[model samples]
Target chain A: AQSVTQLDSHVSVSEGTPVLLRCNYSSSYSPSLFWYVQHPNKGLQLLLKYTSAATLVKGINGFEAEFKKSETSFHLTKPSAHMSDAAEYFCVVRGNNQGGKLIFGQGTELSVKP
Target chain B: AAGVIQSPRHLIKEKRETATLKCYPIPRHDTVYWYQQGPGQDPQFLISFYEKMQSDKGSIPDRFSAQQFSDYHSELNMSSLELGDSALYFCASSFRGGPAPDTQYFGPGTRLTVL
Candidate 1:
């Protein structure tokens, strides 16, 4: 079984400040991890993915995440927070060598404070 | 491309009624998946279709059924709607079959309301 846990249900950050959303996972095998963003009334957009490649994966919109195997975590980070970055973020884990079902975290609602 | 396209952006139905949602996948894609997103919750997998065949069915109930067309389009049919069935139904498409790493593109989703 595979599961993901997002530590924060809501996060607030000031503009131009560094942003971090924490996520942890439990999987039996090596997993494929992904971060997806969903704007209000919009569909989910893939931000980044880690597929057993580089531990540090860069994604769209100047966002990135590091896959930390020892910690069992993959936390999303950004250097500067923009107003447009306000959205719900989901950390997903897909079981390796199994069916292609994705297990999603509870989701983090990011609020950009001006 | 156009990504995935779903029909009936909003639907309302009474109890014991049936609802059908349609989806057209992106061009050159061979896999389609259905997901349900409840309020304030993450999306849950409903079913998946690959090569016009049912690849996997999730924890959905027996009242829910799905079909795929030769053109890679798909339909999700729900019978005997209940209030719990009210949610956003999303259709997604991917390029190939079986564990492909390609990101699934999602449709706008249909908001179903059961009365």
Candidate 2:
């Protein structure tokens, strides 16, 4: 079974400061990882994805995640936090045997303070 | 670029009632996926369709059924609604022949409230 675990349930960061959201996965084989963000009462938006081509993946809104195989981690980071960055983030793993069903983490609520 | 579209952005229903949710994939998109998200919870995959055929399913209740139409649109039919079924339902679409075939674009989602 492929699953993702988000280390933090909530993370607070001041505007212009660095932000980090940690995630780890357990998979029997190589996995396709993804980061998705959802604003209040809004649809989820894809932030980034890792398909094994590159360890470092860049995404929309100045976000990026590095897939570290040894650590079984794919942590999202931003050089600077903006107020609009406040939202819920989910780490997802696509099941290899389930026709690409996404297994999601519990989610990390990001709070960007101005 | 056009994105996925879901109907009935908000819905209120009573227990034991049935409901239908519709989804329209983006132009040229042949794959559709559905998910359910409870309050303050991560979304869970419910089902998926590829080329108008059932492709995958996960955590979907027996009372819930879904199908993709010939036009490539999809519908989810949920029956015997319970309070636990009150949640946000999302529809996503992707083009299998596109460069980024695996990338899914999500819709705004339908918020269903069962009373």
Candidate 3:
């Protein structure tokens, strides 16, 4: 079975400071990893995805995540924080399990402080 | 780019009422997936379809059924609704356009409230 774990339920960061949201995965086969952001009362937006390409992937809004196979981790990060970056982030993994149905993490809520 | 579209952006119904949520996938996309998200909870995969047929299933309730149409649209039908059924339902679409056909594009979502 494929699964995802988001290390933080909530993260707070000061404006202009760096932000990090950690994620780890378990899959029997090579998996496709993704990071999605959902603003309050809004739909999910894909931030980035990893499909056996580069280990380090850059996404929208200056966000990026590194897929570490040795450690089975894919952590998302941003160089600086912005108020608009406040949202719920989900780590998703899609293995060969049944046509790649996504298995989502519990999610991490990001709060940006002024 | 044209994204997935869902109908009945917001719905309110009483228990035992039947509700139908519709989804129109992106043009040329051959796959559709449905997910349910409760308040403050992660999105859970309900089911998925490819080529207008059921391709995969997950965690979906027995009372809920879904199908993809020939036009590549899909519908989620929920019967005997319960308060716990109230949630945000999202439909995503993807095609074999690229190496990662699993890269799904989500719709705005339909907010369902059961009374």
Candidate 4:
């Protein structure tokens, strides 16, 4: 089965500092990758996606991620952190064998300090 | 762009009660997906439908059922709810047949609390 593993359970950073949340996935086929964000008691919002395109994908809210096939990883990064960026981040994967069903990783809760 | 809409943003039910959650997909979207997000847990895929037909299913319990209507709207009907069922239920939609791969757009989710 295809699944994703988030490296950090929680990530804290001071405002204006760089942010990095690691994710590694296991899949038999070329997988579709995505990053979604969830505020407390809110819905999951799409940040970005990787689907056999460019290795680097840019998303909303100044967030981006790179799909490294060699490493089986798609880690999300942000140049600077803001208070509003603090939330739960989920690394998701959808492999062909899964018949397009999305599988989510244990989320990384980001805490941005002022 | 219009986003997926879920009804009864909050629901409270006692054990063994039945709950019906409705989802209205974005305009022109042909697929609908259901997921459950337990507290501090990742969202688990429950079921999905394409063109108002059942397409795929996942870790859904037998006590839970879902179906899509002609209008491409979907509903998840859960029966004999347990305290474990108290979680946020999410509905997502995606458009197929486009040049790009289907990207699921999620709803605000309905928070179900069992007491």
Candidate 5:
């Protein structure tokens, strides 16, 4: 069984400040982790993915996440928050099974304050 | 770069009616996945197809069936639709020829509303 948990349901940060969204996971097999951002009425956009290669993964729009096996965590972060960065963030874990389904976390809604 | 494509961006149906959703994978992509997302909910994996074959199954309801065609396009058919079935249906495509953990690109999901 594979599962992901996002620690925060909502997070607010001021513009130009640092941002963080916490996530954790449990998987029987070595897992593949991903961060996806969904804007209002829009499709999910892949931010970054961790495939056991790099622990610190860099994504588009200056976002990044660190995959910590010991902690079973993959937290998304950014140095500076922009207005456009506000969206719903999902932490996803890919299943090791044949179909490779993606198990998503509950989601963390990020709000950027001006 | 081409991304996955889905049809009927929005749909409305009455209870017990049937609905069909279509998906076209990216060029040369060998795998396609379907996910359902309810309001303010995370996307839930429904099923996946690899090389036109059913590769994995998830929490998909028995009333729903999906298949990948020879052209790599797929269709998800739902029968006896219920209000609970109203959600955003997303189709994702990935190329599995290279390595493990292929990145799946998502399409603009179809918003299905059942009245």
Candidate 6:
């Protein structure tokens, strides 16, 4: 079984400040991790994915996340937060077994304050 | 190119009535998935179809069923609607049976409300 947990339900950060959203996962095998963003009244858009090649993954809109195996965490971060960055973020994990199904975190609502 | 497309962007149904949602995956994609998202929550997997075969099903009830067509288009049927079933339903697709990592592309979603 695989599962993901987003540490924060809501995170607020000022524009131009750094942003961090934490996530932890439990997977039986080497899992493929992903970060997705959902804007208001829109579908989910992929931010980035970690397929065991790189520990640090860069995504669109100046967002990035580091896959930490030992810590069992894949935390999303951005150097400077923009007002457009305000959205709901989800951390997902897919198992390497047969019939791979994505397990999603509870989600984190990011609010960028100006 | 267009991503996954879903029909009936919004729907309202009475309790005990049936509700059907449709999805059209991107051309050439062999996998399609259905998910349900509740208010202020993450999307929950319902079922997945790969090459017109049922691959995986999650914790949804038996009233929820899905089918896939030869062209990879899919439909989700709910036998009897319930108030709890009111939520946003999303359709996703991905390329399967390849070396490429499985990345799902999602549709705008259908908002279903049961009265």
Whole-model lDDT values for every prediction: 0.89, 0.94, 0.94, 0.93, 0.95, 0.91
Sliding window of 10 residues with minimal summed lDDT for model 3 chain A:
A94-103
lDDT of 5 by residue, B17-68 (tens): 9999999998888899999999989999999999999999988999999999
User: What TM-scores do the predictions have?
Assistant: 0.95, 0.97, 0.98, 0.97, 0.98, 0.97
In model 6, how large is the Cα lDDT of residue A4? 93
Tens-digit per-residue lDDT, B40-62, candidate 1:
99999888888898877787889
Candidate 1, residues A1-114, lDDT tens digits: the string is 889999999999999999999999998877889999999988888899988879999999999999999999999999999999999999998644223666679999999999
Range of the 10 consecutive residues with the lowest summed lDDT in candidate 4 chain A: A93-102
Give lDDT tens digits, candidate 5, residues A20-91. Answer: 999999998788999999999999999999998889999999999999989999999999999999999999
Please list all clashing residue pairs in model 3, or write none if there are none.
Answer: none
Residue range A1-114, candidate 4, lDDT tens digits: 789999999999999999999999999888889999999989999999999889999999999999999999999999999999999999999746423778999999999999
Select the stronger candidate by TM-score from 1 and 2.
2
**lDDT (Cα) of model 4:** 0.93
lDDT of 6 at B88: 95
User: Which candidate, 3 or 4, would have the higher lDDT against the true structure?
Assistant: 3
lDDT of 3 by residue, B1-115 (tens): 8889999999999999999999999999999999999998899989999998899998899999999999999999999999999999999999956566989999999999999
Off by over 4 Å in 3: none
DockQ for each numbered candidate: 0.59, 0.78, 0.84, 0.72, 0.90, 0.82
Candidate 2 CAPRI grade = medium
- Give the per-residue lDDT of model 2 (tens digit) for B8-97: 999999999999999999999999999999998899999999998888998999999999999999999999999999999999998878
The DockQ assigned to candidate 1 is: 0.59
TM-score of 1: 0.95
> Judged by TM-score relative to the true structure, which candidate is superior, 3 or 6?
3
Residue B65: error of model 3 in Å?
Answer: 1.0
lDDT, candidate 4, at A104: 96
- State the local distance difference test value for candidate 1: 0.89
